[model samples]
Target: MQFAIENALPMLERTPQVIETMLYGLADEWIYSNEGGDTWTPVDIVAHLIHGEKTDWIPRTQVIMGEGSKTFVPFDMEGHHAVKKGKTMSQLLDEFKILRKENLAQLKTIDITEESLNRTGIHPILGTVTLRHLLAAWVVHDLTHIHQLSRVMAKQYYDAVGPWVQFMGVLGGKR
Candidate 1:
């Protein structure tokens, strides 16, 4: 419901640092491990975030800002594996941080106003979209992934929690 770009930018700005602090010094095994099949490893999650930073947020903003007639391309959720191949986990983290910084810098330079925020564009999947909504989603997307990465990392000790797992909402997936 919030449309203040000033407020949302802080969230986007700190995501990389938050994630880095969370996952730093963990073993390579932990970074690349998941509970089992059909789940994302921490590494995969970071790759997905990087993919969004590249293709989703900034590009769509441009479309809504002035290129409303342009079609917003559908984002590939898991396609970055091939495109981002050969990158180490560290590289992905660093790249995400760099790209996010660039995007935030550009966002700050723009003339954002109520009229600009209300501008609309056509999304391939979501139909017509507004700049405000797109910017809001961009903030939420980073947060969701950060939470997901935390959950996956916490699940590494899912069984280790023993009987207390019943009371542990994170392990129980209650939240």
Candidate 2:
């Protein structure tokens, strides 16, 4: 996709609000429920988001822009959940809001010029990547979790939508 700060900033700015709109004040059943078993709950997704706000986006942006071609730290996807333990889902969402707000504030203070955006960093798995790629991925990452939240919620209606399961790919797929 095109690499423009114009495109990415709004998403970075609005993620917490979108998340709140999707999950604020939801009951524990909705927040913790998932399709059958062995999947992420909305609560888990929020914790993952909180972890990303702290560890992924701006920190990596700084590395790629400032350290150029340096091998970056690998992100621990399955880890970071310990932060969520003992917290209610509402607490998780509120914490994400604060963290995301702080990150967006930090992101705005940085100088993300075309040159900076073109700067590259070595990835442990995906090989070399650029700041442009990271920014784009950040937006897509938010979208992915939003879709995941929707799918998880939709699954609560899986049986209600009986025959439509064939048509509703979200309820049918192993997301």
Candidate 3:
């Protein structure tokens, strides 16, 4: 769990940097593409990350600390995307960065002893799960979405450069 939290810090920092460098000034049309087969826009991805930090990581940690309920509410990804679609990419990215920083700070202060690891919560879908499990999943979730963002970015690059760019042979196959 400590490893997961430590590893997540740099990735969290990189997320905002990637958004600002690669995704800034991109139109909503580019963001909301169907090219990725129902994959979310970059903005939606940011919102999902933010929401996960807020509704999943932080709250679950609070539950572990005995400051909140053990009952975990299942998240609605589609619903989150729908609500997030209204925001500009910059707004979403900013929110994600801020929330991630706050969460990281909070994580650093947590005491993850054997007792904390034994802390359990009632996940709406998975029934009861330990704090360690929750923390591990939080790290997994970050990695999963970072990979998702990379795929989306790759698709965008391929689309922008057109068919012949595929022949440029960086990826050695169809873009």
Best by lDDT: 2
Segments in model 2 whose C-alpha atoms lie over 4 Å from true places:
173-175
* Worst 10-residue lDDT window, candidate 3: 166-175
Question: Which lDDT tens digits does candidate 3 get at residues 55-159?
Answer: 878777787678657887677666566548668777877787788788878887887677787789888888988887887777667767766666665566775
lDDT of 3 at 158: 73
> What's the count of clashing pairs in each model shown?
0, 0, 0
Q: RMSD, each candidate, Å?
A: 1.6, 2.4, 3.9
Show where candidate 1 strays beyond 4 Å. 173-175
In order of TM-score, best first, we have: 1, 2, 3
Model 3 residue 172 lDDT?
41
Model 2: lDDT of residue 84: 89
TM-score of each: 0.93, 0.91, 0.74
Clashing pairs in 3: none
Reference-based TM-score, model 3: 0.74
Residue 94 lDDT (model 3)? 77
Top model number, TM-score:
1
C-alpha lDDT of all candidate models, in order: 0.84, 0.85, 0.70
lDDT of each residue in 48-126, candidate 2, tens digit only: 9998888888888888867454777888887657868999877887889899888888888888888888888887899
